[model samples]
Target: MSLPDPPAPIVHPAEYAFGDQVASAEEHLVGQVDQLLRTRFGKPVEAHLAAPTATDFAALRRWYGERAKGWQPLPDVEGAAKAGRGQGFGFSHGDQAFVMVWLTRDAAEGANPVTILRYGKAG
Candidate 1:
């Protein structure tokens, strides 16, 4: 069977002032997630861009939760660079670390599409 398509990279909301600052961090996160998806499912991770509506949010949550089963939320990201001004949540699968960055309180809402931002074997 083929793998499910991954979520697309999130588009920075208009409120963000300095998105370039986080470009590296964003790439790092994406890479990590892609690696995790490839390793776990034996296929390249595909990202699907979607609006943060109830249906989309639910689908995103279900997808991430299913993929992240047996994975625990990491308390902190070792060597994880501090985001200048963005807000997000982090989780872990064993030593692997994952992070989701966003500005809104409800990252599930507004324009947050790439909810599962990053995943990697934490250092």
Candidate 2:
């Protein structure tokens, strides 16, 4: 199945530390997700791909009745070079998803720890 081109790379501010080391984090993420889909489901006739956002994480926490304790995306990446500038991804097929989350809050290098969660379509 064919998919629309991924969204344009996020134009980060000068202060955002998505440097050369992790410059292609977004592309890497899309590639990772695509690889997973191809390996497991061979791509779907109808698929949805979305870049994760700060609001998305916050909503997840809120949806689960969790309270935030002074957490924020660091303006400069510090821990790991990741697509943590709310630039990771999520792919959904039907009612299920293979979602990616940044473990390190706002990586100092515009990249952070990545966690992928699979739901609904386990098989």
Best by TM-score: 1
Worst 10 residues of 2 by lDDT: 72-81
lDDT digits (tens) for residues 1-123 of candidate 1: 121334644443445332463444455554544443445434332232333433344354456557766676543322232332333344555535455533222444344334334333331
- RMSD (CA, Å), candidate 1 to true, equals 8.6
For model 2, how does the per-residue alpha-carbon lDDT over 1-123 read when each residue is reduced to its tens digit? 111232323122334343454435544544544454555445423222332333344454343222212222222222222433333344444444444434333433343333344534431
- Number of clashing pairs, model 2? 9
Which candidate has the top score in lDDT? 1
Judge candidate 2 at residue 44 and give its lDDT: 29
lDDT comparing candidate 1 with the true structure: 0.41
The C-alpha lDDT values of all candidates are: 0.41, 0.37
Alpha-carbon deviation at 96 in model 1, angstroms: 0.9
